[model samples]
Target: VKIRVGNGRVKGVDLGYKVIECEKIVVAAGEGSKYLFQTLDIDIPIVIRRKELYVSEPYSLFIDPLIIDTREDSLGLYVTQTLRGELMGSIDYPEAIDDLTHETTLKHYTVYAKKLVRLIPIMKYSTVMRCWSGNYVTTPDNSHIMGRDPEWPEGLYISTGFSGHGFMLAPYTGFLMARHLIYGETPNTMEPYTPDRFRMGKYVRESLVIG
Candidate 1:
């Protein structure tokens, strides 16, 4: 995918086989945003890390709210029961990798299982129905990048690098971003997350990132 910019403004996007003309563009392509921005000579401070998660077989409802185990030994493990009674969660400890691969490793599974059983003893008997791996698009400060930059091409906006909180922060961020694009005004709440913060050495540090 190529973002076609002309006259210092977004003109369209070229998707290899076809081109879609547009006046504005919002880049929210997760890990792929790095390469997408590079087409326009823009380099974002985004890093990709590998995250693994597991789900246990359905059991009688036991756990209610999500349990965040921040014990030093647990490595920020979180566990929660889904509506279907399946236990689902992941550990906050992630592995930094360069490639985009969803390959699960036995080492990760073993570590996660031991930690889960240690935190919830009853989980020792539960069978892990499945496990999967995914990528976390992170930034130095662990917060998302939103809004636009005056130095960037006009009509070009960014909303990526949520670190691990994209799903949780999407609704509010999306709303604010929409208002900023439509009204040509950046909201006070979204001011701290402009794409130029990295260059400006302004970071919004967050420490409580749990799975």
Candidate 2:
């Protein structure tokens, strides 16, 4: 659903321009962040990409937490072990998706399933069961937008453009952002992802380990 935004006030009293009635706002808007910043009128140049994942299993199971490989430009399959010793896998494809449906692709399963099975060395004889897609947002440098707005410390704040790595790092990002919101200060660790870096031509590319 779409949330209608207006001048932040009610009963003829302006509550500091933003009516959220809080000291700060951390915008972890996910894929919708592409349109979310329009509310504040900041051009944070990013794109929303649709992505797909796959699930499958053999009669037996193997493996651990999600696995990824940057070379495929798609999600490397992750194997999950079931109680009955069957295997389930999830894939993160890199191809741009056009819609939000979790549709499965045959070619994707055909290519990634076998590789996942091979990684564990026990599924060379198994077949894939399912696959799906979802939405993702990314930026040119793969860094996140953090820190207080220089001109609007009291006006607004946002945190988006996670690319695809936010899920794994959100726990700490949340703690760090929450501290910034409540205390108005963040450590030097988060200083690199200033919101205005893109506009000022000051951007740092993230390490390729998790790309």
lDDT of 2 by residue, 1-211 (tens): 2223335411121235543343344556776665655645556677666665544554643455545543453455555666755565555544654355556677766666656755666566666566556665667787777765565434356677777777777888888888887787778878778777776788888754232
Per-model TM-score versus the true fold? 0.94, 0.69
Runs of candidate 2 exceeding 4 Å displacement: 1-23, 58-94, 97-99, 114-124, 151-154, 209-211
Compute the lDDT of residue 189 as modeled in candidate 2: 76
What's the number of clashes in each of the models?
Answer: 0, 3
Displacement of residue 158 (Cα, Å) in model 2 is: 1.6
Backbone clash tally (model 2) = 3
The residue-by-residue lDDT of candidate 1 on 1-211, one tens digit each, is 9999999899999999999999999999999998999999998988888888999999989998999887787878888999999999888555647558878778877888888999888888999899988888988899899988789999899999998898899999889988988988787789998988889899999887775
Top TM-score prediction, candidate number:
1
When summed lDDT is taken over every stretch of 10 residues in candidate 1, the lowest stretch is 90-99
Please report, in order, the local distance difference test score of every candidate based on alpha carbons.
Answer: 0.88, 0.60
